[model samples]
Target: MSPHPQEALSTPRAAGLAGILFGLLLGTAIVLVRLAVPEHPASAGAWLTDSSRRSAVQAALDLVPFAGISFLWFLAAVRDRMGEREDRFFATVFIGSGLVFVAVLLCAAAAAGGMLATAGGANQQLWGFGHSFAYTLLTEYSMRMAAVFAFCTSTIARRLRVLPRSLVWFGWLVGLALIGGAGNVSWLELAFPVWALVVGGYVLGAGSGRTASG
Candidate 1:
């Protein structure tokens, strides 16, 4: 049986919208969190005394859940776009990695929220632990999962000829940066959002044509 016409039409649009939302929210959260939390190992204690930092952290934490939701929607839309052409093995990896990424990101956000909540008591040890835990999740574990998601998505897209070759290559590059540079280079995490923005733009611009072609 043929799929519904509306399903094809809506999937790409949903992917585009979700990608845009996810990119914006994640990017903003990252910037706000970076501003709130200094990189210096010794500065962990200062967050308790700084009202601005606390507010920034709170704002970033508030954005994370929304970002994660959008990312999940984006994944669903991508799967819908793939339809019957998607290989089960790659699809499993793609969906699994994306879910793991969101889960880890939320854990990181929760740790940050805990840090903010505990800031009132000015517990230096707790603040330090939270800071380390959150950053490790954000810059290490979550990003590695994101990298796997990117690689799987790109591979699927390439095999199915869903995205342009240039875009597929770009995704690979971004995945590499996330996998290799995220731990050492703080800003490398931004590559994920940037890639999402580009993919979103492509989806928006191509509209029905790309979906039909794919």
Candidate 2:
């Protein structure tokens, strides 16, 4: 009636690796989309007319599904690492927020992809609506969910003493920025992935050290 001995080590490795991949892919996609798309929701859909911009947006959209998958894995890894020490309230919020973030992120990508697919001869008004909707979902809605998730994650990690205090503090700051500054500040969305990258690097290093010691 004992758990597998390798469970602890395995979970950290999976979480660390998946988190790193999620951070890299998501950050790259966000940069690409920002460069290609207008920040204003009601702006004219002029980018649709440019083939290079279209290609960049398409490439960013293509990375989204993979990023989402990696994020799911990373979520699982984090939850598993928490084990029995996980608080039920925080767990509910953490899982719920993370899932909502992925859902909105995917929905935003789909909306953008649809717009790109209809680039030629698409109705200008409709294209504008889609563009606005996609960015709204990404920057406004998804980032809010990301903020909640980050806050819950940091709180849980701090409670469990699993992560360094510096990283936990960074997570709290990231969460605050996402909550208060997401839509107004350009490039602020990058905070989520940067947090992921930092946490992932730490998890990977710690996991490696534990494995070596074992």
lDDT of 2 at 150: 93
Tens digit per residue, CA lDDT, model 1, 133-209: 88999989999999999999999999999899999999999898888888799778888988887898788767767
Q: Give the TM-score of candidate 2.
A: 0.95
Report residue 171 deviation for candidate 2 (angstroms). Answer: 0.5
Clashes of 2: 0
Q: Candidate 1: where is the Cα deviation over 4 Å?
A: 208-214
Q: Write the residue-wise lDDT of candidate 2 on 1-214 in tens digits.
A: 8766576688888888998999999999999999988876455456766889889989999999999999999999999999988999999999999999999999999988887777577776787788788988998999999999999999999999999999999999999999999888999999999899889889988999998998
The segments of candidate 2 whose C-alpha lies over 4 angstroms from its true place after superposition are: 1-5, 41-46
User: Lowest lDDT 10-mer window, candidate 2?
Assistant: 40-49
Clashes of each: 0, 0
Write down the worst ten-residue block by lDDT for model 1.
39-48
Q: Would you estimate the TM-scores of all the predictions?
A: 0.93, 0.95
